[model samples]
Target: MLVASLTAVGAQEGPSGITQRTVFAPFDPTQRGCHKPPGLTKELAYVQENEREFLQGVNHGLEMAAKDRGLKYLRSVAENNVPKAVEDINAYQAAKVGALVATSSDPTAVSSSLQRTIWSGAFVGTIVPPPATLLLNAPQYATGKALADASINYIKSQLGGKAKVVLLTQDTMEYLTPRFEAMRDAFAKTPGVTIVADIAPTPVNKEGGFVTMSTVLLANPDIDVVLGGDAVVLGALKALRVAGKDRPNQFLGGIDGEPEAVSEIKKGNSPFKASISLSSPVFGYAMGQFAADWLDGKSIPQAMDILPIALTSENMAQYEADLENPAAVYADPIRKSTYLKMYGNICYDTRDQYVNFPWSSESSK
Candidate 1:
C-alpha cells in the first residue's frame, strides 16, 4: 500500500488558473529495485546544474530529496555540454549509482546515452527537457499562450495596445519557441504594436542580452516593451536604463521568474512587469521523490508537467511563500494536487515504457 504523506493533493490550480500542469504515474512504493542497493561508497548522481535562482530551487529540491532518501548525493555541471552530460551519467553508471536525475539537460542530445544508462540498470529522472525513466514537462503551446495572454493584457490595459516591442528568445529550443510565437501572434492582432527587434543572443544570458539589446537600440531607440527569459530581459533592463529608455509606459516581462524579475515587479512603477515561473524546487523535489520511487523498483510516472505561474506584484507574496516551504504548501490539498499528476506506471517489467525522446504530457491529455 502507498503511504500518503500529509494528504493527497487532488486537482491543483496552475498559474493559468486552470489545472496545475503537475503530473506523475502511479507506483507501488512498497516495492524495491531488482539491483542490489548501492554499497556504502556509491551515490545517486544529479547530472547537471540548473543555474540561476530558478535552478537553484531545483538543486535544493534534489538535495532535500537526497536527504529524505538517505542517499549519498553527487552533482556535476555540464554547463550545457551534451558530451559532458553523457560522460557524467556514465561516471555515475560506472560507480554503480542507484539512480540519476538529469535536470533540464537536452533530451535530444542525451537521449541515446540516457537509454544506455537505463540498459545498464540504473533508474533515471528528467525535468523540463527529458527522455528518462521519469519525465516532467509543461505543454509548450500552453506555456507560450499563458505568457502571451499576460503580455496582451498588459498591452491593452497599460500600454493602450500600442508599443514598440523587443523579443529576446532562446529560439534554438523548439519547445520554447512557442513563447515567442505566441507573443508575435498577439502583437499581430493588436494595432500599433510594432516588433522593433526579435533576436537571439549568442550566450543566452544577461550579458548577451545586454549586448544584443544595446545593438538593437542603435536603430530602435523607442523600444517600450521587452519579452524573453528573465536573464535576457533583465540584461535588456540594464541596457534600457543606461540608454535612458526605462520609462513608465515601457513594459518588460519574461519566463523563468528569476528573483531579479520578482524584485522588478515589486517596484510597482518599474517597467519590469511579469514572469512565468515554474517552481523548480517544488517540482524538483517531486522529481527526486519520483527518482527514489524508480530506484526502489516502484512504478514511476513516465511524464508530468510543472505548470508555469505568471507572477506579478499582486501574487508574488503567496508564490514566494509556497516556494519557501514547498513541502507545507504541497501539503495543502489544492496546491499539492497541481504539482502531482499521476499517469500509468512504469517498472522494470515495463522498462519499454521508459521514455527515450522528447515526450509531452499533452499527448496523454
Candidate 2:
C-alpha cells in the first residue's frame, strides 16, 4: 500500500504474503566530502518547527533519552523556514554539538543546511522528513492506505458508505501527500460517497483546520466524514460542534495519535473514530538513542521502517504506556527491535553513505 518512496527489504516473501524487506545497507563514510571530527561531546540538540502534541512527545523523548544517556540537551524551533533553519543549525554546529535530533516540514528546502550540519561532524537524526544521518518516517503510501482503510471501514459501519467527506490534506510535504491520495482512492469506488470539500489548509494546525472547515461547512453543511492529521481534524471537530453539527452519523479520523484525538476516540460517542498511531515518543526515543550511538562511533541503523499502529479504544492503554514511558519499552530487547527496523550499523566512518535527501533506490549490500 505504501509503495512509493519505499525501498523494500528485497523480494523475500513469507507465509503471510508480506514482503520481508532488507532496509539495512553497508555504508562507507571514508569517501565523505567533509572532514572527520573528534569524539562525541555527550550532548544533543533537538530542533523542530511546530508545537503540536505530537512534537511535544518527540521532544519529551529526546529530553528523556538525553537524561538516560547522561547527555546535556538543547532545543530550538526553526519556524519551518529554510533560511531560518539554516542559520539556527549554523549556530548549533559552531557550538560543536555531538548530535542534532530534528524534523522538518520541507526537507527539500532545508537539505543544504542539514547536509552542512552533518558535514560539520555532528551526527544528525531526522524524523518524518529527511536529509540526515538517521531518517525516520512511516512508509507514505502504506501508512496512508492503512489510515484510509480505517476511515472507509468506519464510513461503511456507521454512515452506510453514503456521506459527504472533507479531506484536509498536508500534500506539500511530498512523502505525506500520499496519505490524502490514499483517502481519495479508497472513497473513489464507494457509492454515495461525495467529497464536498477537498482542501489544503495553510498551517496544517488547529486554527488552520478550523478556518478551512468553517468555510467548507458553509458551502456543504451536510458533510459527515472528515479526514486529516489530529491537529486539523480536532480543529474541524471543534468547528462542527460549535455549529451544532457533531452528530453520530458524522465520522472523522486523523493520523497522529494526539492526546485530544485519542481522548475523542475514547469517548466512544464522538465523531472522531480513529487516529493512526505513529507512536511518537517511541520513535523519538529511538532516534535520540541512535543519535547518541552515532556520536559514540557505533554503527547505527542505515534506515528504519516506522510502521503505523492504528490506535483505538482497545489498544490505547498500551500505546499510552509506551508513549508515557519509552525507556521502559526500549529496555526489553524484543520490543525495542519491533519499534525500529534496524538495517546496518552506521557511523561517521560511513559518512559517504550517510543518507542524503532523495535516498538511493537501492541499499548497498
Candidate 3:
C-alpha cells in the first residue's frame, strides 16, 4: 500500500516543479553616458551618455530589488542599439528559459521585439501584452487617463468654467493619440476644461523638438494648465522657464518623477503641481519578489499586476528613503538581509526550511 501511495504521489508530481531560468535583457543605453566610446560623434556620445545614466539608475534599483528577494537574475545587453533588442530576445527564447525583459528605450522597438520573439515563443511566448505594462511605471495608459480625468475634474470645479488646458506629451503620435482621445472623452462633460492643444512629438529629436515647441507655444499663448504625459514635460518646463513664462500661475503636471524634476521642485523654481513616480527601486523589489515566488512554486499573480502608488512632494522623501534601504521599506530586515547575503547563491537548497514540506514534516516528526 505504501509503495502504491508513493507511485501515485510521484505521478501527481509530474513536471509540476519549475526547473528553467528567468532572464532580464534591458535595452542598452551605454552610448548615452559621459564616457563616450571611441569613434562616436560628440553629439551622439552625449545622447548615449544621457540615456546610459537613466538606464543605469533604473538597473541599480532593479538589481537592489532582485538582491533583496533572493532571485537569480542575469542582465543581458543588446549592444547594437534598439534593433539589437530583437536579437537578444531571440537568443533568450532559444535558450528555452523564461524571461522578464525590461527597458527604458523606445516602446516601438521593445513591442516589436516582444511580438516576434518572446510572445511568439514556441513554448511560452510573451509574459505581458503589447506596449508592455512594465514600461510607463506600471500605471498604464488606461490608469493614467483615469487619474488625469480626476485631476481635470477637480480643476474644473475650482475654476468654475473658465480654465483652458493643454495636453503635452513627448510620446509619438502613434502612442499618444489614443490616450488623447480618451482624455477628450473623459472631459467631454466637464465644463471650463478646454484642451487647447495636444502636442505629441519626439522630445529629444532636434528638428521635431523645435517644430513642436514652436507650434504649441504659438497656438496656445492663453493656455492655463499644461498636462504632460511623460518626462518630456521636463524639457517643456525648461523651455517655459527660458521664455519667462510664469509657472505657478499656469498649472503643470506630469507622469514621471525624474530626479531632475525633484531637484527643480526642491529649488522652488518648478511649476510642477503634481507627478506620479514609479519609485524605480521599489518596483525592482516588487519584480524580485514576484520572481522569487514564481521560482519557488508559489503561483505568481498575472503578469499584468497593478503597480503600487504615485509619489508627490508630500511623500517623496519616504519613497526615496525606501529606495536606499528596501529592507526597511519591506518591513522585514532579517529576511531581506538573508536574501541579500545569499545573492546569486539563492537556490532551492538555500530556501527557508520552514517553507519546505519534507523538512517541516521531518522536524515535526
Candidate 4:
C-alpha cells in the first residue's frame, strides 16, 4: 500500500489564462536505471552524470517555487525500482484511481500497458537526453541545421564566402551520426564550406582527446570552425589548449553546456563561440504544472509535448536567474501554487517515477 498526503492550495490564472495548480512530489533517482548496461564510455558517462545533476537542480528549483506559493502538495515516502513502478501503477489502477504519473523511457511500453488505466492522462519525463536519432528524426533538426548554417554563413560573411572547416566528434556517438551526416550534406551544398577533415575517435574514451586533437591538427591545419556534439568536444578543446593549439580567433561551438565550458568562456582564452542549452528547469517545471492541471480536471491541449525553447549565450542570463529562483521565472504564481497543491506530502517519496511502465495488470504478462 502506498501511503501519501495531499494538501490543496488555491489556484491562480496563468499567463495563458489557464488556472494552474501546484503539485509537489518527493523525487528519487536510485531506481531509474534497472536495465542500464554497465561500462559506458566516458562521453556517455558524462552525459548521464550531467543529466542527474540537471534533474536534481530542477527539483530543488521546484521546491523553492512551491514554498513561495504556499500551495497544497503531495509527498511520496517510498523507494522502489523500475519493476516496482509497474506494480504501483497496477495497484493504483485496480483501485480506479483518478489520475497518476508514472515514469519510463519507452513510451510505447507505457502506452501499451496503461491504455485502459484509471488515469485520464499521463506524461513521461526522460532522465536521459533525447537520443541523437530522436533529435534528428524530428523537425527540430531543421532548426539545429539552420543554426549551423547561420553560423557558417556568419563565418562566410567575414571570410569572404569560403572557408575550410573541420568537423570533430567522438566516434562512439552513434546516434549523432545521422545529424552530423545531415550537417555534412548541408555543408556540401553550401558555396564556401569545405569539409577539411571529419574525424572520429576509436572508442570515445579518455583517449578521445589525443585522437581528436592530433587528427584535427594533422589533417586540417587551417580548419576555421570545430563543430562537435557535447562534452567530448569540450574535452578536446581542453586538450587543444593544453597543447597550445587552441586559437582565440577560431570558432568553437556545440550542443550542451558544462561548468568547464563556462569557465573556458569566462577566461576568454578558448575558442568557444557559443553553446546550445535546453533549459531543464523550465522543462521540468512545465511538466509538473501540466501534471497538476491534468489531475485537477483541467483540459490540456493536445500539443502539450511541444519542444522546449533553446537557450543561447544571449538569453542564458535570464534562465540562470530562473534556475536560481523559479518563483520569479513565471508570472503566474497562483497557477504555480495550484500545481503544488496536488502533490501534498508526497514530496518526501524518493522513488524514481520514470522506471515503471503502463499501470495495467496486462503489463505483467
Candidate 5:
C-alpha cells in the first residue's frame, strides 16, 4: 500500500505485520554540501517493459544522459514478459550495476528483484510502485483533470457541450484510480456530457483500445469524445476510422502526448486533440542525471513528480525540442520547473531511507 506522508520515526510493523520504514524528510532544495562518495561502479542500466513509444522516449533520454555523464549505459527489453523483466533486473544486480532504472508490466512480480538490487547498495529507480532509492510519478488526479477539462472545453465549443463520451481507464491499478475518479467527477457536473462507456481496456494497449471501442460502437455509435492513455485511444481512433464513424468536429483527446497522437492532433481535421504531455524523455533524463549523481556520492531527489502539460499544435514544436534536448531543459531552472517537481533527498550514505512504498507528491497532500 502507498504511504503518502513520510514518517520520521524508525521502522515499525504495520497492521499486516509487515515492516515499514520511513526515515526521510521532505527534500530540502536549499540544503547543500551533502555528499556520499562514490562506492559503486559508474554503470546505469534500464529494464524496459517494452518498445512502446513512451518507453522508447525514456530509453532515448537515459541513453543521452549516460553519454553526457560518462557512464556506461545498458538496456534490456522485457518484451512485456514479467519473468524476463525479473531476469533482467536480477542479472543487472548480480553484475553490480551501480544505478538501475526499471518499468515493469507487473511491478509486484519484480519487487523482490528490485529490493535485492537496493540491498546491494546500488541505486534503484522505479517508475512508480517502489522499493527504490528514487521513484518517478505524476499527479494522477491533476493529470486526469487536465485532460478532462480540455475535453470539456472542446465539447462545449465544438459539440454544443452534449456528447456521448468513452473513457478508457486503468482502474485496476490502485495508484491510477484517482485519475479516472477525477474524470468522472468533472463529467458528472456537465449534464450533457454523459459517459456512454467507462471501462478498462483489456491489456491496456492499442489493440485493447481498438477492440473496446469497436464493441462500444455496437450500441452507442455516436461517441463525440474519447479520453484515455495514448496507445489505447489511438487504437480507438483507428476503430473509428475503419467504421466510417469519425467526424472532423469530434473531440478525441488523450493523455501521454504520444508521437502518433501528436501527429493526429497536428492534422487539424482529425478528431484527436489535446494530449496531456507527461514527457517521459524529460523525466528519464532527470533520472539518469540522478543516477550519475548517486554514483558520484552526490545528493539527489528521492522522488519526482512529472508535471503534466496539455499539448496542442501550438506547443508541440517546443515540447518536441525539449524532449530532444532534455539536458538543456534540466539545466535551465525555469524550464525544468515547467516539466518536473522533485521532493525528498537521498545519497549513498542515507540509502537505508530509500522509498519502499508508493510515494507521490499529490497523495502526500
Candidate 6:
C-alpha cells in the first residue's frame, strides 16, 4: 500500500475550522508562520529511493535551491531498500536537519520517523503518501488518461482504429492503481482496441518490463500500442526491437517524461510517441524554497500538485529548458503553473495540521 495507516497524530481541524480532504483550502500563511528564526537551520536532506532519472531531477533542483537559498544539501540513496531508507531518515533526524524530502518503495516503514521529523519543528516533504508538512502528489487518473488517450488516438488515426495493445501496469501500488484503471476505462471505450496483455511487471523497472513483455510476446506476437510508465514502456520497446516486432506506426506511450522516453519520441519514426510528465525538478525546487521559507519564519503551501504534461517532440525543447533551469521556472508564475499547483498553507507553528493521509486534488470533486 502506498499510503500508511493514520497514526495517533491524525488530522485535526485547521485554523480556518476546516477539516482535511483530498484537496485543501487556499493557504492561510498568517496562521502558520515561520517555524524558527532565520539561519538556525540550513540543511536540506533527501532520502532517495533509487537512482532513477525522475528522482535525479529532484536532487538536481534541491541542490540548486540549496545553493541559491544558502542551505546545505545532503542526500542518501536507499536504493529501494526499506531499512536503508529508515536508517537514512533517522540519521538526518539525529542531525536535526531543517528540511527533508523523501521517496520510498515502502512509506510505512519510514512514516514514524517522518512524523518525528515533523514533530521536531522541521519541514518534511514526501512524494504522494503523507506524514509531511508539504506533500506532493500527481493527479493519477488524469495522468493515465492523457497517455491512454494519446495512444488511443494513434490507434484510430494510424492503425485504422484497430490494434493490439499491451498495458504494463503498477497495480501493486494501490495509490497508483488509478493510472491503470484510467487506461482500462479509456481503452474500454475504443471498440477496436484489444488489450493483449494487462500485467504489472515484477520489480516495475526496465528489466521487469523486458521480462514481462518477453513473456507476453510468447503468446501474442503482435503489439501495436504499448502504454505504461516510461521505464517499463522503454523496456517493452527494447523487447519488441529484440523480437524484430517493432513497427514504425506502432504507438508506445508512457508517463514520467523520462529522458530515454523523450529520446525515443524524438526519433520521429520510433514507436515511442508520448510521455506524460510529472516534472520533478520544478516541484523539487519549490519544495526547497519552502524549506528556506520555513526556516525563515515564512508560510508555505501545505501541499502541492506536480501537474502532468504530455511530452511530445513538438514541445520537447522548451520542456528540457524548463527542466534544466527549474529555479527560473519557479521564479516565473506562468511557467511554474504549467508544472505545479499549490494548496493550503503550513509553517512550523501550524504543522500539527500536516497531511497524514493519501491526498489528491482530483478527489476534490
Taking all chains together, each candidate's TM-score versus the true structure is: 0.83, 0.83, 0.60, 0.56, 0.91, 0.92
- Using TM-score as the yardstick, the better of models 1 and 5 is 5
Better of 4 and 6 by TM-score: 6
- Candidate 6 Cα outliers beyond 4 Å, as residue runs: 1-22, 28-40
lDDT of 1 by residue, 253-360 (tens): 888788888888998989888888888778777777766765665666666777778888888888888777676654576886665565546654455556655566
- Per-residue lDDT of model 3, residues 1-365, tens digit only: 00111111112211111122222222221222121112211110000112433345445654665566654445655543665655554454334333344452544455443333222211111212232212222324553565466457547664565667766654454433444555666667777678777767564433443355456777665655666643555666655665665456455656545676566545544566555554545445544554444343333222222232444567767656765665465457543332221111112122111011101001111
Q: How many pairs of residues collide in each model?
A: 8, 13, 9, 30, 2, 2
Q: Please give the lDDT score for candidate 4.
A: 0.42
| lDDT of candidates 1 onward, in order | 0.71, 0.73, 0.43, 0.42, 0.85, 0.85
Model 5: residues >4 Å from true position, as ranges? 1-26, 29-39
Residue lDDT tens for model 2, 1-365: 11111112222221111123334554343422322347436688987866778888899888888888877999988766756666666667666678887666666666655666665556778775556677776766666777778777877887776788899999976667777777888889778888898888878889999999988989788778898988999899999989887897577888889999999999988888888888778888887887776766666765666777778878888888889999987788787665655544556665545565433223222
Give candidate 1's TM-score: 0.83
Q: Candidate 4: minimum summed lDDT over ten consecutive residues — where? A: 40-49
Lowest-lDDT window of 10 residues in candidate 3? 353-362
Off by over 4 Å in 2: 1-40, 79-84, 104-109, 359-365
Kindly report which residue stretches of model 1 are placed more than 4 angstroms away from their true locations once superposed: 1-43, 80-83, 103-109, 339-342, 363-365
Q: How close is candidate 5 to the true structure, as a TM-score?
A: 0.91
Model 4 off-target regions past 4 Å? 1-123, 126-139, 157-160, 168-182, 199-216, 302-314, 332-365
Q: Worst lDDT window (10 residues) for model 2?
A: 1-10
Ranking by lDDT: 6, 5, 2, 1, 3, 4
Q: Between the candidate structures 4 and 5, which one is better when assessed by TM-score? A: 5
lDDT tens readout by residue for model 5, 1-365: 32211222122321121125343466665656655433456899999999989999999999999999999999999999999999988888777788999999898999878766766667888887887789888999999999999999988888887989999999989988888999999999997989999999998989999999999999989889999988899999999999999998888888888899999989988899889999999999999998988887778888888899999988988999998999999999999999998887877666667787777777645
Model 5: which ten-residue window has the lowest total lDDT? Answer: 9-18
